[model samples]
Target: MAQQETDERVSDEFIDDTKDSAEREQAHRERGTVRPITVVGHPMLHRECRDVTAFDEALASLIDDMFASQRAAEGVGLAANQIGVDLKVFVYDCPDDDGVRHVGAVCNPVLDELPPDGRVLDDNNEGCLSVPGAYAELPRPDYAVVRGQDATGRPVTVRGTGYFARCLQHETDHLYGHLYLERLSKRERKKALTMMAENTPRYETVPNAE
Candidate 1:
């Protein structure tokens, strides 16, 4: 998803980085099996994913695979449905506007309501792995918070600012059956799809039926 660095700034307090986070992120990718990403036209990408109920080894494995797939696609964030699994889980390894890296997974994510006083908009170029090779300008909250469970079903709250905030919002939208394209005007959306059709994604994808 457009990892383009920007001058977009956020308060340092919102950054969620721990010393072991990077090491854990690396370990997941190493143990994961990369899976093909499902495209825009695929049914899985168009519908809401099932809320994860079991927080067991199977869920852990899926999160692992998601990290592997996101790395393969060179994405900052990924949702379970993007890998053809209809589960409300997403993994992210993104940096805030300050370039502080934040890495983790969220299951059954619910975006916290942005307060009117703090609702600053950041209009930036956004892309998706499901709609590969295309990006469009979209405005999103410059800061975001999501409440969900970790892979082990532990309650978790994640907050971010700048580009990482965009990543959180984008991945949550995926779980709710929405794509960044949905926020764009028809003309822009068409342009992005045309761009995708004209170029080839570097990563493997599951083709949608014609």
Candidate 2:
């Protein structure tokens, strides 16, 4: 059996510091004119992502761009909408049992319920690039069966458990116009919003409010 594990000490800095010059250039080119990271309240983030149709150069390029954005932002996973693109795609780089990096992208993805014999639900702290600086403890199924295509449009099926499953579930939610905050309990949501409201000052002095 394949074992899965996540090393929390693996920071975003590790990704940035390790990428070579050519990879960096390719990433920048893939992102093109679009910004790599989009903030909260962006309409694209709330819109349901469209399916990938062609699987041509554009689709492949978008996959690269998603990976670039993921690494640049130091996120375990990223969705197309988070980068202002409304395509059903996401990229993830997580550690294996040996703590080696396993990076990949998925397009027009789908997640099925874990096998009846699999593990139970596990709650973990999760954050999003779209909602920067906010982390929440969200409950996620302990395992997931994902089906999607790779950069070259080849079919792929992955059975993920533990943190990898958590990351995949999180990214899949973004594709469906859902955010982690939506899964929080009412009291949790209120507390989180209050914290955001307190830490994020609103500039009432600006003319927009008046």
The best candidate in terms of lDDT? 1
Model 1, which residues run further than 4 Å from truth?
A: 1-16
lDDT of 2: 0.64
Per-residue CA lDDT of model 2 for 1-210, tens digit only, reads 011122321111212212354454456446643335665566676668887766787876776666666666667777888777778888777653345454667676677655656658687777666665567788888777666665565565555667777887888888888888889998876776665546532211111110
Writing each residue's lDDT as its tens digit, candidate 1 over 62-125 gives 9899999999999999999999998999999998888778899988888878889989999999
How badly does each model clash, as a count of residue pairs? 0, 0
Estimate TM-scores for all models.
Answer: 0.91, 0.73
Per-residue lDDT of 39 in model 2: 55
